[model samples]
Target: MLDIGIIGASGYTGGELMRLLLSHPQARVELATSRRLMGQKVSATHTHLKDMVDIQFENPDPHEIKDRCDVVFVAVPHGTAMNIVPKILDDKVKVIDLSADYRLKPAVFEDVYGIKHLDPRNVVYGMPELHPEIKHEGFIANPGCFPTGATLAAAPLAQASMIDSVVFDSKTGVSGAGIEPSQASHYPNMAENVQPYKLTKHRHLPEFTQELQRLDKNLTNISFTPHIIPSVRGILTTAHIFTKGTLTKYDVMDLYTEMYQDKPFVRMMDGIPSLSAVKGSNFCDIGFEVDPRNNRVVVISAIDNLVKGASGQAIQNMNIMCGLDETTGLWVPGIAP
Candidate 1:
């Protein structure tokens, strides 16, 4: 069995990690750290995981985690992971970080994050379906929530050289903002509203564009926008893509179907998929329509922002890194309203 530790275990992503890992057949939760809730029982902060795990949240200390587990999932924010990851890179442990710290090349990292990377060359992007071969690498950088939905929707088109340009508009739940209480995410403002924030400067933009460019160098002129809805979970991304060649809607559908044929997590639907359909599960459901008159194709994808978008994907990477079944502990169905 692989022993797993999670850093930053008080937030939405960390709680989701605890929920999923509690049922994993071959994995055990050894330690989960949270600076805010140190020494508190895991169940105290996240009632959903109350009886599922008996572990307590601890403070972030590399020495405490390195000796207790074979792998670690860093669920902390961007700048924080950089400070902790480098210290825990001994040969005994593998790490999957669910932050934007090492998702891009050093130059691109600097451009988007506005910081010179302290160690950029050692980490690989951790979207398993997109980069399966790199799963065994020592360190992995999990993709952002918005990028996960957007990239899966447009990857097939980008890979086929069929898309000329792409515009992505993502609507996600307020929980994606994290467990912290902010004025924007306060119940009064978010309860009955759909607000569009981060118009052009969402941090996920560079990670999204960089991955698409990796698949097709000709993929240029991409635009992305993200919004926050009042819901508690899920991300719905719509990609407006201009095709380069003559391809019908059926052709585009076929491309996505074939591309994800062997992949178990991506679900291709005939009609548009709703956010509730994929909530609480690690599935990315995609559907698209053709706008022949405008020479465009519209692709829509949905995922539970906290699950597939963050902690679930981090666990998927851990399974791959450890040579276990990729779907080991993540086969639960979506929770319906």
Candidate 2:
């Protein structure tokens, strides 16, 4: 079994990593680090994983972490990862950062997130379905939750260069914000209502731009708007993909199916995808329809923002980096109610 460490293991994504990796057949949790929750049992911070793991939260020392773990997942915020990752990264240990630090180029990252890169370097964008060659790399930058769902929803169309303008409207759960309590995440503010934040821009905007531009350089018409719903987990992205010419529903379905046929985690839905259908699982359920009158093909993609969107996808990246089955710890069906 491979020994793994999770830095910043007190937040939603970190707790999720603890939950998923505790059961991973080939990976064992060796260390779970949190600067604030030091010495506390990991399960104490993540009550949901109370009986699932036995590690305590320790303050991170990059050198010690490198010596202890075969692989490490950095679950800290965007700016926080650059501090830890720059210290421990080398060929002796593999790193997967679930942060935006390494997802975009220095200029673009600084422009979007309004921050400077202290230790910028190239790392594979960890979306195994889109870029399975992630298997060949030692370090990976996990895509943002919003970008993962939105990109998968519209990538096929972008690649075919059949699009004119693409507008992505995504509804995400509160958990996507993180484990920290926030004025935005306040129960009364979020309950029985939907609030749309980042109307024209979000930090995840650059990720979609980088990935899609790889397929078609001239495709500049990408727009994303995100909303927060009252739910605890999941992101549903409705991509209003306008094509250069009219295409039938059958044609678009074939395109997505052909692209994702061999990808295990991306499930092509026969009908519209439901949030409940993909909740608590590492599946991205994609369903679409063609509105011939307006030349609009509405594609809906759903995923548990904490699963396929974050921790589960992180584990998927580790699986690829270690030359294991991409779905090793994450092939189970969703916990549909």
Candidate 3:
């Protein structure tokens, strides 16, 4: 069994990783690190894993972590993973970073995040559907939650060179904001309201654009706007893909089917996908409609922001890198009511 270590284990993503890894037959949670929560039980912050995880939070140096874990998941904040990753990543240890640290080019990451990238290296972008090369690597940069849903929603058309321009309007749960309580995540403000922030220049926009552009170099017009919904855990993205030509629904469906045929986590739906269909699961449910008159295709995708978007995707990368079935611990139904 693979010995797993999770850095920044006090946050939502780290907790979610522990929750999912609990069921993996080939993996075990060997270490869970949280500086402040050191010596405390992991179940304290992650109440959902109360009876499931019996491990205590420990804050060992990054160097020591590399010795203990066969695989390490860096689930820290945006700029923090760079620090821990450089210390823990070695030939013996594979790393999957759940941060924005290594997803983009060093220059692009610096420009978008407005922080100097301390450690920059080329690593496979962790969208297994797009980058099959991840299976050959020891390091992976897990895509941002918004980009996970938005990019998957429109990737097939982009690969077919059918997109002229695309606009992604994504609704995400408060959990995407992180476990920390903020003015935006404040119960009163978030309840019975929808707050749209970073209208045109959200940071995740670059990631979505970068992934889609890789499919078709000439495809350039990509815009993304993210909103925080009143829900607790899921991202529902609506993509308005203005195509270069008029296509029927069957034509679009064919593209999605061909692209996602071998992908176990992507579910193509006949009707629009809903958050309930993907909540609490690693699946990304996608569906689209054709607007022939306007030469447009409206696509929608749903994913658990914390699952397919973050921790779950990190684990998916692990399975691929380890040569295990990609769905080893992740092939389960969503908690739809």
Best by lDDT: 3
Candidate no. 2 TM-score: 0.98
Question: In model 2, what lDDT does residue 302 have?
Answer: 99
- How many residue pairs clash in each candidate at the backbone level? 0, 0, 0
Clashing pairs for model 2 are none
Index of the highest-TM-score prediction: 3
List the candidates ranked by TM-score, beginning with the highest: 3, 2, 1
TM-score for all predictions? Answer: 0.96, 0.98, 0.99
* Candidate 1 residue spans exceeding 4 A from truth: none
* Model 2 backbone overlap count: 0
Residues 91-185, candidate 1: write the lDDT tens digits. Answer: 88999889888888878878888887777674678898889875558788999999999999999999998878999999988898888889879
Give the clashing residue pairs of candidate 3, or none: none
Please identify which of the two predictions, 1 or 2, would achieve the higher lDDT against the true structure.
Answer: 2
Query: What tens digits encode model 2's per-residue C-alpha lDDT throughout 1-337?
Result: 9999988888888888878886789999999888888988988878888777877889867789999999999988889888888788889899989989999997888888888998777778999888978988888899999999999999898889888989999999999988779988999999999999989878898899899998889899999999999999999999999999999977898788888999999998888898999888999999898999989999999999999999999999999889898889888888887
Candidate 3 deviant stretches above 4 angstroms: none
Q: List the residue pairs that clash in candidate 1.
A: none
